[model samples]
Structure formats: structure tokens, C-alpha cells
Target: MRRVERALLSVSDKTGLIDFARGLSELGVELISTGGTAKALADAGLPVKNVSDVTGFPEMLEGRVKTLHPMIHGGLLADRSKPEHMSKIAEHGILPIDIVVVNLYPFAATVAKPGVTWEEAIENIDIGGPSMVRSAAKNHAAVAVVVSPSSYDGVLNELLRNDGKLEAETLKRLAGEAFAHTAAYDATIAAYFAKKLGEETESILPAKLTLSFEKAQDLRYGENPHQKAAFYREAQGGQGVASARKLHGKELSFNNIYDLNAAYNLVQEFAGEKDPTAAIIKHTNPCGIAVSTTLADAFTKARAGDPISAFGGILATSRPIDAATAELITGKNTFFEAIIAPGYDEDAFKILTEKKQWGANLILLEAEFGAEAAGENIDIKRVSGGILVQTEDKHAVGRADLTTVTRRGPSDAEIADLLFAWKVVKHVKSNAIVIAKDRQIVGVGAGQMNRVQSVRLAVEQAGDKAKGAALASDAFFPFADGPEAAGIAGVTSIIQPGGSKKDGETTEMADNYNIAMVFTGHRHFRH
Candidate 1:
């Protein structure tokens, strides 16, 4: 344990400053401060010495050069255990500052306000504060640094318990927190500049990418029972699954988070439509999806598309869940791992929780829908050694982007089904095939190794429904076999990105089969 004799305190946030200084003064520790902090402590009837008195140099440059002095830094950075360091400080009449308490300017909050100027933001970037913190942290074996007011009570308790001394372990922990605080502060500044410069250059990737996450919870297990796992939320708030509120259910597992995100994203595709939309997701793939006039009708049609796969799946809806929709979801032989929606009616909420066995274990989440497109957000994927960052795939095909590739053009009804199927296929995994009639999905084949197998699986699942249904592929078919299989299944129309080398052959095959095909220059490949 190291006894604290002299302390320096400079802070932008002065919470608990007077009381803390009084506590230290009562314990025979000298209090030294600067600027407003010194004035505040003196006004509170505590004896405080200004920093200029110790350094023999007044603050200049509007208080910017106050603490950049040898007297302050040598005291904070000196090693007490080394005889040479002690002799050098003694020869210079420098007293060791056992405690350094500081908190930097609120750069993040200042820039977050509306219409903050560049000049104002640049002025708020702290220099001396981070320097003092690092000096004390680097010499943590002999100094204790406090960076947050939330830590004041703990420090005070330890000081009182140990009779004005702090253990090495406490100093080490506080040093770690101090470094993390500076890193996050610097990262916020870097990200702000990156955003401003990135817009003009049309490059979203930054030279240095610094991300920080806060632990939200420790889970029971990971994807399996043996693996340990935890959940983390980004330091910056955004609109995503992490912002959702769990109204009821068992603790969410890792797999539950994956499927919930997939279901919610799929349902959000129909956010612009007046009709209600619903999606059922299993294993990060949409098993069924539909848009209908009523919420109940949407849920029923979505479930009817693939009832077996819907079991133990996650359900997401774009509208508030009503009693009728809740009843359909909780029917006999129906079981869902979770359900997410904008809101839940009182009656519906009570029935689902009170009258069913699976409801007690089901995860219910409430999230906002249709706020805005996710095009501006960056998407990140982790690989073996590094991460791949790119913009989110929010590109949607409009009516003008579609080009007819066959002699037979899509009819008005077929065009509508093709558009709906295109939206659903974008959320599916790579090598995906989706069959839709009207505005509801009839069958979906996702995450297949080959395009032809996906088409066959979807066509086989659709059965007679494939006769006039529209098909959508996430990417261009490498060969004509996929379109040929769709033709044999009686698919009336198709939509795919036409970038393949065999595009001409695929179009010829479509003409021979009397099928209408449209090329949407953009492709969505989700893996």
C-alpha cells in the first residue's frame, strides 16, 4: 500500500469535488488544483493551492499551458522506489503527487448538439488532461489516478478503510480504466473527422477503425451448452436488434439473436406498404413471409407456406399484434421460439402468456419498424485474422431498373409477384430461390450449394402453386439449368441479376419455355 500525501485535481465535471477534497484535507493531504476547480474548492472552505504556485508559471493561452510543466509531470511520473528518481526530484524541489484526479472535456456531447461549429469542436479536444492521466497511469505502481466521478465513492471507501492509503491492485484497476477512457475519447474524435471527410471522398472506410462495445449481459451458453458467451452493445446507439426491449421470455440465446435479426429485417422490407407484413425465420433464413390486409391473414399465410419449418422459429411482424393474430400463432401444434412486433394489444398479450405452455418460455421483443433505411450504416464481418467492413445492402430494385430479357414480358400480376419475391430473396442466404404468388411466399430454398438445387427445392415445395408463381434468385445463374428447372416447374416469370457470361443462353431458354424474365442490374448475395 502507498500512502497519499499530496494530490492534484483538475476536472471539467466537478461533481463530488468539494466533499472529496474535504475528505482528503481532513486526512492531512495537501490539495492542489487549477482554474475553476481551485476557486470552487476554496469557496467550499477547503484550503487549495493553485497549480501556478507550484510551477512558478501562470496559465497562458487561455488556460491551455497551465499543467504542461515539469513540476506537475515529474511529480506524477516519478518512481518512488528508485533512489536516482527520488534524488533527482529532491534536487529540483519537486514533491511527488500521489493522487491525480482528472476528467477530460466532453468533446462527444459538445459535437452531438445541433449546429456545433468546427471551431468549437476543435477547441474542446483535451491535451493536458490526457497527458496527466497517462503519466499517472504509467507510474501506477506509485500513483493512483481517478478519471470518473462514479469511482469517487469507491476510492473514498478504500482510503477510509486503509487509513489514507490505497493498495496496488486498486491503483492498477483505476489505471486500466483511465487508459480506456482516453482511448474512447480519441476514437470519438477520429470517427467524427472520418465521417466528415468520408462523404467528400466517397470512401466510407477509415484509415484507422476504432470500435468499443460495452458488455450488456452474460448468457447461459453460446450456440451450444458447452461454449461460454456474452452480449455486447455498441458504444454509439443506433436502430437495430441491440436496441430492442424484451417484454417477456427466457433469456435470449446466441441463436435466438441471429434468427430474430433475420426475421425483423425481412419484415422491415415491406415497411412502406399499407398492408401488414409477417416473416418466420429459422437458422438465420426466412422460411416464409407474406403481406396481407390484416395481421391475422399475414401470419396465417406466412405460416402456411412452410408449417414444419415454422415450428420452433422466430416470428416478426410490421404491425402491432392483435388478439386474432396472437391466437393463430398459438394454435395447437404451433410452437415459436420468439415473436417480435411493434406493440402488443393488452388482450393479445394476456392470452399468449396465460393460456399456452410455450408462451411461458417464448421470447417477446418490441421494436420500432419503418423508421428509416439502413443504407447509411456500415456492416462488419469477422474472419480468421481481420474484419471486413462494407456498406449495408440496402439497394432495392425499382420499376425502371428492371429490363425485360425474353420475348414474353411479365404481365401486371406477374410483375407484382416478382417484385415481392425479389424483396424476400434479398434477405435469404446465397444461392437462394423464392417462389411467390399474389403477395405471399409459396416456397423458399435458402443457403443451397448450387442454384439448380435451390430452384428444385422451392419448386418441389410449391407443388401446384408453382404453376403461375414468380421466382426470384439472389444472384445471376452461372448456367441455364436454374431457369430450365423453373420452366419445368411451370414458373411464369423470373427476376435475377443478369451479369453471368451465359446470360444470352438463359434468355433464349426462357423464350423457348414461354417464361418472362427481368434483369435487376444489382445482386444481393448474403452469406
Candidate 2:
């Protein structure tokens, strides 16, 4: 442990600067600052020496040239462990800085602003702050680095508890955090430049990908009870499931987070639509999905798709949960593990929180914002030795993208059902099949071994409802058995990608069975 005698303080976020400086002053520590930070400390009635005063040079270039002098860095980098290192700094009339308090400029926040110019974003990037942080962190055996306002209280408490000295372990932890803070800051800058430089769509993946994350929470276990797990949130774009605010119920488990993320993502697919939408997900595949005139009706119809699977599953809705919707959800004895949405009406919140059964344990997460879409338009999967990266499957087949392949064209109602089923199938697992009627998912067969098996599974689930329903296959059928199964189930219309050698056979079968078949020309295969 080393006694802290001097602290260099220069930060863009001055959250706890006053209180922390006062605490250090009480410990007989000298305060050194730059520019606005110096002015703020002096205004707070704390004695502070300006960096220009210490270096005997004035800040230049519109305040960008402050704290770049060797006087500041040499003090932070000096090794007190060596007698010569301390004597050399003293001989040069330099005082060693024991702590560095700094936080970089808000490059991420500035770039996120609407209509922000390139000049503004470039200006917000801090050069000297990161340099000072790195210098102090690199010499953390003797120096302590503080990079966030949130660390002020704990650091101050430690300094007071130890009579102005920080333990070696504390120094190491602070240094690690300082490095991560600078890394995340630099990563944000690099990504912004990549966007501004306009990398061609053909070169979507960068030569090197640097990702930064911070631990959000530690879970009880992972996918299985025996596995360890934790949640790490992205440094930038702090939205979606990672940013969700839990309004009620028990803490989220590992599987609960995954299911909530799945439900949240699928619900975002229908954002800003005319009708209210709801989806229930089981094991990351949505079992029930529907859009209806009313929020209550949407939830009711969605649950009707597969109430057995919907039990204890994750539920998500497009709009806020209204009183009627809340009543409908709790009306049945069935229970859901969690529900995520934009918000909840006051009455709805009360009813759900105070429900008769399973209410106390039901997790309620309120997104509270637009909850617009999935963050980061790319997909990443871990493999045995390396990783696979691909662009997100955001493609949607509009009505104009459809081509009638069979002799009979789908009726207007069948077209609506086909489009609805098309959207749902894209989110299901590979070899997926969806049966929809009147904008409600009647059945979903996902992750089957073969396309024909998926078709049969969906038809069986739909039962009587399959008679007039529209079916959507995520990919083209390799054999006519899929269409033949749909035909025997009395399916009236079908939508698929239609790019197989046996497309001729499938088309012939559809024509023979009077099933209106259309090719979307796009395959949505999820794995």
C-alpha cells in the first residue's frame, strides 16, 4: 500500500467531483485539475492547481491541448518502489500523482444524436484523458486510476478507511476498470469511423472485430442447472432485453433471459403495425402468435394457438398491457414465466401483480420506449474452435415480392393469412412450418428432421382449423410430400421460396389439389 498525496482530476463527467475532492482535501491530498474541472473545484471552495500552472504552459487550441505535458504523465507513471525514480521526479520539481480521476468525452452519446455533424463527433473524442488514464493504469502497482463517476464513493471510502492509502488489490481492480473504460470508448470511436468511412455492403464484416461488454448480472446457473452463467451487456446501444426494467416479480433466470429476449425480438417484428400483436415463445421458438383489433383479443387468440405449450412460456406484446388484456391473461389458470412489453396500464399492473395464482412469481419487464427493433444488425454463433458471423435475417417478403406459381391465385383473405404466416415462419427454427387463419397462428411445426414431417406436425396441430388455413414453409420443399400433406389437411393456400428441382412436382401437386401456391423468392431458414 502507498499513501496517496496527490490526485490528478480531469473529467468530462463531474458527477461526484466536489464531494470526492473535499474528502481528499480532508486527507491532506493535493488536487490537480484542468479547464472546466479546475474551475468547478475552485467554485466549490476547494483548493485546486490547474494543469497549465503546474506545467507552466497555457491550454491552447480551444482547450484541446490541456494536460498533455510530461509534468502530468511523469507524475502518474513514476515508480515509488525505486528510490531513484522518486528522487529524479523530486529533482525536477515534479510531485508524483498517486491517483488519476478521469472519464473520457462522450463520443458514443454525441454520435448517437440526431443530425450530429462529423465535425462534432470528431471533436468529442478525447485524446489527453485516455492518455492520462492509460499512464496511471499501466503503473497501477503504485498509482490508482478512477475512470467513472460511480467509482467515486467507493474509492473515497477506501481512501478514508486506510488513511489516504489504497491496497494493492484495490489498485489492480481500478486499473482493470480503467483499461476497460478506455477500450469501450475507443471501440465506439472505431465503429463510428467505420460507418462514416462508408464500407461497402459487400465488405460488411471488418478485418478485425473488437467487442466490449460489461457484466450486467450473475445468474444462478446457465442453460442447465449445473452450468455457470452471467449476463454481459454491450457497452453501446444499451437497449432491448439488456436494458429492460423489471417492474415486478422474482429475478430473471438464465433461461428466462433467453426466452424474454426471443419474445422481445419477435414482438419488435410487428412494431408500429395497425393491429395489436402478441407472441408466446417456448424454448426460443414462438408457439403462438396473433395480431388482432384489441390487445386482449390478440393475447387470447395467440394463447389459443397452443395453450399447452404456452403454459409457463414467455409472452410478449407490441403495445402496453391494458386492463382488459391483463384480465384476459390471468383469466385462465395457465401461468406464464414472464411478460415483456412497452409498458403496463395502472389497472393492468395492479391486476397482474395481485393475481390469485402465480402472480407473485411472474416476471414483468417494461421496455418503456419504442422498443423499436433488435440491436446490432448482425448474428454471431459460437462454434467448436472459432465463431460464425452473418448479417441478421431481417428480410421480409412483401406482397410485391410474391409470384403465383399454381393455376389458382390465393383469395384476398388467404393472401393476408399467407403474409402473416410468412412472418411467423421466419422466426421459427429450420424446417419450420406455420399454419395461420385470420391472422392467428393455429399451429407451428419447427425444427423437424424433414420438411414433410414439419408439414404433417403442423397439420395435426391445427386439426379442424387446418381445413381453410394458409401454410408457410420457411424454405422450398424438396419433395411433394409436404404439399401433399397440406392438401390432405385441407390447406387452401401455401407460400414458399420455390427453388428446388422438384418444384415442378410440388407445383403439379398444388394444382391437382386446388391449393393456391405462391413463391416468395426468399428463403428464411433459422437454425
Candidate 3:
């Protein structure tokens, strides 16, 4: 290949730009730029050539038509290895561009603004920049394409080491990075357009789907030790578990991430509530959950609901961890795989680190996520050959949304406990049952084969504590057996989504047992 001679430079992110440009200049490579980039280089006392000078055509159309001329593209796309192609470019007075350094406009950020207009979003969709990047990438056999400032140092080092020329492998790798950059850019634009169309047409979910994600970490293993796994995150991450910052402890595992996500999502239902909430999760199912006046009280009560199952489980809470809660977590043979909260006090962090045996090894994360409606939330699952996509389950019910289907109505305390149990049950697996008293989860049965079995399991777990507690089922009881089992266990108030044909039987059973039952008209199935 030919030695590196001329490199085009146009980037929105100027990070490491001047140093890279100076390195290229020291290697005797010419620098070509457009618009503000050229002005910046000249202001910095670096030699640079304007695209207008190279193309003999000034930039027009509000600076949108800068480098779309044949002079620029021909330099990037000409086949340097072919004598005929080289001759044709030379005949057209177009010098070959050995390197391309570009980064597109910030389309994603523009659309993410609170009150951005369509004209502003459209204006940020770069045209000439992508065209030049594609041209350089398509001719990677003879040209080097770079679309990120992160790649600048490596490119300059290689050029300095190889006497101003890039290796073929380096060229190929840069080509891949270039294409990925443009692809991610286009995907963001596509998403913005999809949002605009939905706003205009009163519809959501686009005809085509485009997504971009970056690897967060490589896990030791997946659900099992034999399987491999890696965690990926969105390019422009919103607040959640994946975007949470690890404040302390060991690396998270595959199962830890799943359980953390489950626990975090469950606690989000209580966001902005006056009382703090806590949920202890194992295998993506909550063993216990509770809301209380203080964060420490909530944690103690949630763990007390099922202390046996809480061993080595993941805990998620809505409020910051205080010193009192840290004391309870590290007291008396207590162990947890991870704990996530919005923040941690200095004393709490110190206490947990010094008191717990596995404190240094515990995964602690801080994330800020709250409940909001009408978000573009999507849930995806992978199958054998494809993926299943649907809207995330954000359905919520209130007291006014419920109908008392039994002869008796629930008391104020029972109503509060029932609502709390309902929120927890919505995150549980299908055929789920949750029993709670005084806003504390006493028992939970999830992923059972039948609704009756779930009820039996939850009642058994709750034992004598099931008496006078509120029971919440994710869905309506298919038969009266579920209510009969809860009734026999002394459950006083029950809440469920009532759509079954045998709803009358369930209601009759509740009435006979003097159990007040309410129907939410909504189902939450998380299978």
C-alpha cells in the first residue's frame, strides 16, 4: 500500500483531537478539515486545509452541504491498489485521502431534550458526515476510517511506529469501528423518527426495530456455572439496575443481575411513597417484602418475614441505607449476595464494611429509578431462533379501581395490606400468591403448577401468621379451591384479578368464609 499522505478530520467530539492532529503533522501527513474543525485547528496554530479549498466548492445549505462533493468522496473511495483507478482519480485532480477521522452529530441527545422540535431533530441528522465515513469505510482496503476519538491515539501510535502507514489489519479493524459508529447513529435517528411518528399518529411501536447496546461486563458464568454470560447496556442508558453504579463489593454474577433486576423492579412500585420499602429476592422471586416508617425497620421486617429464605439473597430498597439497617444486615450470621439502594450514608458504609464477614465481597450498588407512566418501556425475551418483544408490565391498581365482590368490604388496614401485597405479587412468577399483614410480607409462593398449590405453599410458609393477613393472587382463582385453601388458612382479605368463568364460586367461597374479596380487573403474570 501507499504511505499515509493526507487525512480528513471532522469530529463533533474534540477529545484528544489536537494531540492526534499534532502527531499526524509531525509524521508529515497533511490534515484536511471542514467548517469549525478547520477553524479550531488554525486557531490552535496547527496547519490545516479547508474542504472548500480541496473541492473548489463552498459549503452551502446552512453548512449542511460541506463535504459531499466528488473531490472528497473520490479521494476516500478510489482503489489505491488499482493503477486504472489511481489514474482516473489523478485525472480528476482528486488526491487520495489516506485516513478519515469523523464523528457524527449528536442526534440522540437532541431528541432526548424535554421540548425539542421536529425541525431541530431533523437538522441534527448529519448527511455529509455519514456519506464521507461510508465512502472511507467501503474502501478500507486502501483507506483507514476512524469514527471515534478513542481510536485516535492507537491510530497515531501505529502510524508513528510504521512510518506514517497503517497495517492492513488495523485498517480492517478501524473499518469495523467506522461502520458500527454510523450504524448506531442511524439506529438512534430511527428511534427518534419512530417516536415522532407515534406522536403524530397516536400510535407506538414502529414497523422495524433498531437497537444498540454496549457490553458492561463478562460474567464468571450464566444461570449455571457451565454456561457463559455477559451483561449489556443501552448506549444512552436511563436509570435502572444496568445503569446503576457499584459503590462497593465484588463483581456481580449472572444470577445476581437477574435477581437484582427483579428486586429493583419490585421496589420501584413503591417509589415516592412516604414509607420506605424493602424486598429480599432469591432466584428472581421475592422471599419477603415490606414497607415501614423507617428504612431500617422496613429492612428488619422484610428479612424477618422469611429469614431462612433471605440467606444469601439479594436485597433492594427504595431509600438510602442508614447505620441502623447496616447493623441489622451484618448482625448474627447474616449473609447476602448483594444489596442495592438509592444511596448509602458514610456511617452505614463503614459499619457494613467492618461488621460483616463477607462485607468486602458483597455487591453493593446505588441507583436512582422512580415510577413514571407512559414511558416507552419494552420487554424482550430470547427463544430458540428469535426474540419475543412486548411492552413491559407497568399496570397498577388503586382502591377506587377495585370492586368489592364479596358480601363484606375490607377494613382500612386490610385494604392497605392488600394493596401492598398486590404490588409485590405483580412482580412474582405466574401462579403466584403473596400473604401480608401490617404492610409486611409474611409468605410468598411463586412459580407453582397450580393456583391452589401456590395458596397451600404460601399458607404453609405463613403458618399461623396467615390468620387475618391479606392475600393477593396475580390472577383470578380458576376454581374455588384456591379461596377454600386461603379460607381454611384463616385469610381475612383477598385481592385478585377477576375474569374467570367460576368467579361466582370463588366469591361464594370467600363469602362463606367471611373473607372480604376485591377484584382489580387487571392481571400481572410474570412467567
Q: For residues 490-518, what per-residue lDDT tens digits would candidate 1 score against the true structure?
A: 99899999999999999999888899999
Model 1: CA > 4 A from native:
6-71, 87-95, 108-124, 148-154, 373-375
How many backbone clashes does every candidate have?
Answer: 0, 0, 0
Task: Output the lDDT of residue 518, model 2.
Answer: 99
Off by over 4 Å in 2: 198-203, 368-376
- TM-score of each predicted structure versus truth: 0.88, 0.96, 0.96
Candidate 1 positional error at 39, Å? 7.9
TM-score of 3: 0.96
- Per-residue lDDT of model 2, residues 1-527, tens digit only: 57999999988888988999999998999999998899999999999999999999999999889889878888988888899988988989888999999998988778777678889999999999999999999999999999988889999999889888898899999999999899988887876666555343544567666666678999999999999999988666646898899999998999999999889888877876888899999999999999999999999999999999999899999999999999888886678999999999999999999986788989999984344432345578999998888877878877888999999999999999999999889889989999999999998899998999999889999999999899999999999999999999999999999999999999999998899999998999999
Report, for every candidate in turn, its global Cα lDDT versus the true structure: 0.90, 0.89, 0.89
For each candidate in turn, give its C-alpha RMSD to the true structure in angstroms: 3.3, 1.8, 1.6
Error of 3 at 239 (Å): 1.2
Give one digit per residue, the lDDT tens place, for model 3 in 1-527.
46899999998888888999989888889999998889888988999999999999999998989899989999998887789988998999999999989998988777767678889989999999899889999999999988888888888888888888889999999989889888988887886777668778866578897877767899999989999999998765567898799988888899989999999998999986889998899899999888999988999999988999999999999999999998888889689999999998999999877754788898899998574423466688999998787877878888899899999999999999999999999988989999999999998989998999999999999999999999999998999999999999999999999999999999999999999999999999989
